[model samples]
Target chain A: MPTQANSSEPPELGLSGRKIIYDEDGKPCRSCNTLLDFKFVTGKLTGAEGTKPLSAQAPAECLEKLGTGTVTSAAIGESSSKAYPKEDPPDVNQLGRASWTLLHSVAAKYPNSPSDTQKQEMKQFMTIFSHVYPCGWCAKDFEKFIKHNSPKVDSKEDLGRWICTAHNEVNEKLGKEKFDCDLWKKRWVDGWD
Target chain B: MPTQANSSEPPELGLSGRKIIYDEDGKPCRSCNTLLDFKFVTGKLTGAEGTKPLSAQAPAECLEKLGTGTVTSAAIGESSSKAYPKEDPPDVNQLGRASWTLLHSVAAKYPNSPSDTQKQEMKQFMTIFSHVYPCGWCAKDFEKFIKHNSPKVDSKEDLGRWICTAHNEVNEKLGKEKFDCDLWKKRWVDGWD
Candidate 1:
């Protein structure tokens, strides 16, 4: 069984036979039921209207109306673990580590005296990277960081140190220990002594 | 002692008290000496000119001229493990995994019916991503892939399927098993069965 909340009707009973809880904004509380409930309620409120209640509907019927097309509870149950049968996708920490690696490696390879084209490309890359980064909140934060401390792409050393300092700022926000900016090359490019 | 290779002069000897090995293309072979050899040789070939021979140069002098500044063999030794002192940056495999996760997640979250702006943005993101991807060889390969099989971004399902197929191409190249495209939604967005 699933839960249901209608914006048109007063928030009362859910499809799971539990009372629907509303947030201060009068939207159904997301934590009240499964993610399906949240989607159903929000979907109804937004575009689709007068959808059949989930309690009275079969899974296929509900999925068809929702335009999700034949989702099964078994699939949802397995996916609840957040791992696919064959592989698990990277989480936030993994994404952070990979992104840092790419950034540092790029800095490591940045020429000491970049051509005008190279410098402009780097700038464009950073701007587009900030916009399209998968994590919306993290991307927004990075955009602000970039605005405050614009990329220094004049030289490799300068760019490396600038990026290191910026990364340290993120570390500070996350309560992680800050890295020494002076050791940027040693850590990222050349082997440490 | 660091090795030396001059593009002007024939590849002969190295400061490591050993002969420098050259690839078929006459570039210094990466396997010989250390990563230092590759950097020094390539650095010489590219920008810095006539930077005295490493054989005659002290570690300090070499570092200064190279603009790498005070790298020690011990530092390289530690970084060889691919882990920084405090943090381990993602290696190629880790980066691949994380990147795939981010790509799939983004595709999953893409709107079923996106605005023109969203469609253009996705296309632009892929183009920039191909250019700025940290791994140079991988970026070149992806560019080829993009050229051959352009992104299908009309709808969320189209985008997801397109990305999954692209990922499969990479997996195939890596000699990894291909994923069943039918299960993409289950694996990425809706849990798997």
Candidate 2:
């Protein structure tokens, strides 16, 4: 059983009152929620209102709410029970999904017969995206992925297929289902038929 | 009254069967939904289920579901009254929001005192982002914005502030509230207290 923290008082407004999981350098860990869950089976979770323990399963509706990124900022605090009505910052998974959507959408719109300049720019974009992506470990993984499989910018279709394959690689690593590359056009460019 | 297309048979599975607003070159117009709505004011809409006309209002629950990117792809097709159970591709607004979230989150995590290489990479990232953002008009506007106010990537804080201001500019154009720049750390780096 996880240690239960007393939750009687209304929590303070900011991170000052929260029990943040920190790294060796005292910086708050980006994956604090996962880390905290792994270390202890705490019944009460922080940063999300009505978050259940890791062992306890939440109903589909609750999970849907959480997945939709509707949880308030106050609920995300360290052990706070109050649900302030402010949008919470997205976590790594949310960020990743969003980033992938943007990237794939952009690729879908790439000019079919792109100029040399366009191709060069797309390559640069991927390189920079790998560098600036917020998740440190994920960025490193992308960088390595790029090194092994350079971007194919010959045409719009090429770029779209390349991105889809790259996305599938990430999905495979995460144990998620791989999207059919053949449906790339249908999914992004042409819409499903 | 808007011209009503006969809703006799179930539409084809692809975008071709849908009445997508297209440019002269047969490319799907970026503002198809808006264009379609302007041309027709019928309660029944296509391409994005539950998407209201610009003048109409959606209830909070519908808006929340839209914000959460929950509408299925089937909801986006022509005359599809049945709501499919699977996750759908994100619409333009949802895609934009998600993209912004990733960009802002990455900017928030930038190194405060970035090295020259980091600075160069960040600058490059902005340039490429402006060029390749999926929305055509949005990309053009971003390009202009970049030309007017070059990206400031000297430090992490500088980048965060710059991005926040840029985001606010977009918000201003969209008639949305501007986020407080002072709360950058609280919103992105640290959990709110």
Candidate 3:
């Protein structure tokens, strides 16, 4: 069947009496759940809220940015070896990667010598972006990041480097490898000649 | 040698007087050039401005958004066999694809129902976004799009569909497939059941 152009149906909880994820109002938090859990919902293998899948035999922190405490452990013998479904909508990680691509591209093409008005526009864009990003915790962290770094819109190179450092901070939190910020131009504007 | 934490060096034109890409002010237009050209500058195989490579043995419209008219042909007998270098900084197409991913995900995670304040914030974000998108021509087109469609921030579903339609317009212009807007929820918010 052809998918309709529009539907008002709420997303399926996919919970058969299992509270996998939600906020205070019992709404599934899209920004908090990994596609791994969303897949579990589809397969009817959902655990209760604060439930996080363990990739190894160690305890894991639940997706807790929008929830409560992230315990340093997982249930023993849970055999945490599920592959995430890619066809599903983005999870937190996917969203962040895509947003970084766009955000960095913005800085990449920024004028080398921007007018005052252009500089102000970039600053304003960052302020409003923090509000509209779907991840509440991520946005709050960005608010603090902006307070400290601000948007260095004086030039394209400056803005790109600033944004890259900001991304490195997020990488630190996620345990991802840090990109070489010195290569910001190579990554976003000029090729690594 | 370690990549610098910072450098004020201008991007290498990679030109041996070939005038491959530049605006009127003799500056490289980051948003105007493709990674392919950037690579060429690295290899120094540049043509004049408005030059676009042929992917097949056929005439092609030069990338003319930030330039003048696109001629309907490649130079005769030029082999169109070059593959875009993956590690180069993003070109216009790569930037567009990434931006679409982030923009769509925002709608996906949006609250199913939102407050007026949230709605205003979303609308403002879009407004500012069109201005700050690095591609000037693309941004102008988006400005026209927003003026015509406005933003449907009243509901997540509404915004998703609206943004999907907007993306379809871009897809159409790029001669790419128009994604089924009906499957938007499946693509952006939920995995297929």
Candidate 4:
């Protein structure tokens, strides 16, 4: 059964590679196996919150079909060592589908994501966000926020502010008095973004 | 086999669903089936590009496996009307994929697409452009230009002149020494800001 960590707490975010199903000797990649690297260049993970899979994480069946040889894990570094402490309090927002969208918005707004891996993560977040919130109006609002803040952005704080503004506006237009920024923040993290 | 229209001349950009597709009783849908009202709105054409089949037009064999219905078609519009009458052709630099990137740069800069369709199309164009071109540096330059010009932009003519300046700077940096503004003017319809 899949593990279910607290779906509410911010969890530690990291990238993982497939575990090589090796022969008895544990040699390198077998002839029929290919090792794929699933790197989470940046993510928010709190033990209280479960690690939501990025949309890029194919179904287990698909991964099995790819026939990965082995799996390895690595911890993603917090973007700025001085900016965030080693063990910041768990962020409730980084726990669900909403948080995933938030993460993507955050990553996209990051000013200096120079590596291909960062770009890939951002793309994955966008794809997953599309599936959960399939509204054009929402997308328009998000895009507007990103376009304005992307050049000047580089962290989750920037995205949080954008989301705060966008979500409020969207909810207001929908005439829904109950807008859940924190709920969405958790969903964004718990889901994928 | 895919139908080939004029290879040298720009064909008319019209949706196929604009024509009537008669039912067994010979009744036409009051609404046109063109790509928009049919597959696009339903999300069937999400990742489609040139030659990508719309759901309504998918092959019977393909649809049958998925348990679908049949569709009939007749070319309604005159083929001669495909090309636009000479109304100042768009600039050359504004043709094809490159021009599309420029359009998105404008949209991304202004970030208020006319419609959801425009947003979706712009996103698709950006995806394709990113894959085909080393556009990061160029995008930065475009962004810079937009930042400066957006404040003064008031009319289409202003936009055109701004595009002319940005395109020249970009082409110059990319070593496109022979780049002609007249050519870009002709293809400007492709999308420039």
Q: How accurately is candidate 2 docked according to DockQ?
A: 0.49
- Could you tell me the lDDT of residue A93 within candidate 4? 15
True contacts kept of each: 0.16, 0.55, 0.80, 0.00
Best by DockQ: 2
- i-RMS for every candidate (Å) is 2.9, 1.7, 2.2, 21.5
The global Cα lDDT (0 to 1) of model 2 is: 0.61
Model 1's lDDT to the true fold?
0.59
What is the lDDT for B161 in model 1? 98
DockQ of candidate 3? 0.43
Residue-wise lDDT of candidate 3 within A45-158, one digit each (tens)? 334432433333232233323122221122322112532233545566557767888898889768889999889888888887887776677888898999998888899989
Clashing pairs in 2: A13-B193, A14-B192, A14-B193, A15-B193, A47-A76, A192-B14, A193-B13, A193-B14, B47-B76, B112-B156
lDDT of 4 at B136: 35
Model 4 chain A lDDT-worst window of ten: A87-96
User: What ranking of all candidate models by lDDT puts the best one first?
Assistant: 3, 2, 1, 4
Judge the docking of candidate 4 as incorrect, acceptable, medium or high.
incorrect
Q: What's the interface RMS deviation of candidate 2?
A: 1.7
After superposing candidate 1, which stretches have Cα over 4 Å from the reference?
A: A1-86, B1-90
Candidate structures ordered by TM-score, highest first: 2, 3, 1, 4
The positional error of residue B25 in candidate 4, measured at the CA in angstroms, is: 70
Name the weakest run of 10 consecutive residues (lDDT summed) in model 4 chain B.
Answer: B85-94
